[model samples]
Target: MEALLSQFSFLSSQALQDKNFDPTKIDDLMKFFELEAYNSWAAMETDLKKDVDEAEYTMKEAEDHLESVMDSAMDEFRRFEEELDRTLKDELDGLEQVANNAKKMGSSMENAATIATKKYMEAALVSATTTMKSAWKGLNFNSKKIHPS
Candidate 1:
């Protein structure tokens, strides 16, 4: 207030009037200062109100940004989860296919072994029969030579 008084020439011929100058009196220094002070106060109030309004706007913008970030984060999380699920399912399916292939291969190997064993037994039987027939022919020929019948 004193700074305002010093900056502006508060002392003048009108303010030189008596100390009991009527406040309601027009064209008086007291009335002019009173109006000036009210105007200054009103201007300060208006500036403060503008500041408050701007701060509210900034706060609302910040809240909106935070909400958007949260929504994006949730969406990203859902996508990651879905991707993980798909990878796991695909891996399980591959494993199942591998298991099935291994089972089929095992069965095929068993059948091949059985066929080889059957072939080996048949070949042994044929060899034994040929040997027996050759021995019988030799015995009959030797008996005819010894008896001369």
Candidate 2:
């Protein structure tokens, strides 16, 4: 919808730019349209004055309407920009939070792995110590029996 309005604004400006008037031709045309007579000058003067008055009124009305349209367009544009800014900011915040959560998850996984490795190493050491003590006791008993006299 905003795109359509912007396109309309562009086309309207283009139309204003393309409206080239030939003042000489226009003046000749206006003169040709004037009536001829003694009171014609007075009548022409009155008619021209009326035309001028009408043109002025029309110009003022058009200017006022254009001003109103421009004000509305400005307000809409400001609102659109603010909305876009807010949307982008929200998306950015969501991404940041996701990144933070991933980091925390990675750290927690690493801590769990370290603890498991430490516990496994401790259990292996205790099993090896027990096996070595049993082997020594068996060796001593065998030596004493063979040496008995």
Q: TM-scores of the models, in the given order?
A: 0.52, 0.56
- Taking the tens digit of each residue's C-alpha lDDT, what string does model 1 give over 1-149? 56545533544434466676444443454566678899999999999999999999999999999999999999999999999999999999999999999999999999999999999999899989999988987676545456557
lDDT of 2 by residue, 1-149 (tens): 35445655665566567777445544443454442333568888999999999999999999999999999999999999999999999999999999999999999999999999999999999999999998988776545455458
Candidate 2 Cα RMSD (Å): 22.2
Cα shift from native, residue 114, model 1 (Å): 1.7
User: Looking at model 2, which ten-residue stretch has the lowest summed lDDT?
Assistant: 29-38
**Candidate 2 Cα outliers beyond 4 Å, as residue runs:** 1-38, 131-149
Q: What TM-score would candidate 2 get against the native?
A: 0.56
Best by TM-score: 2
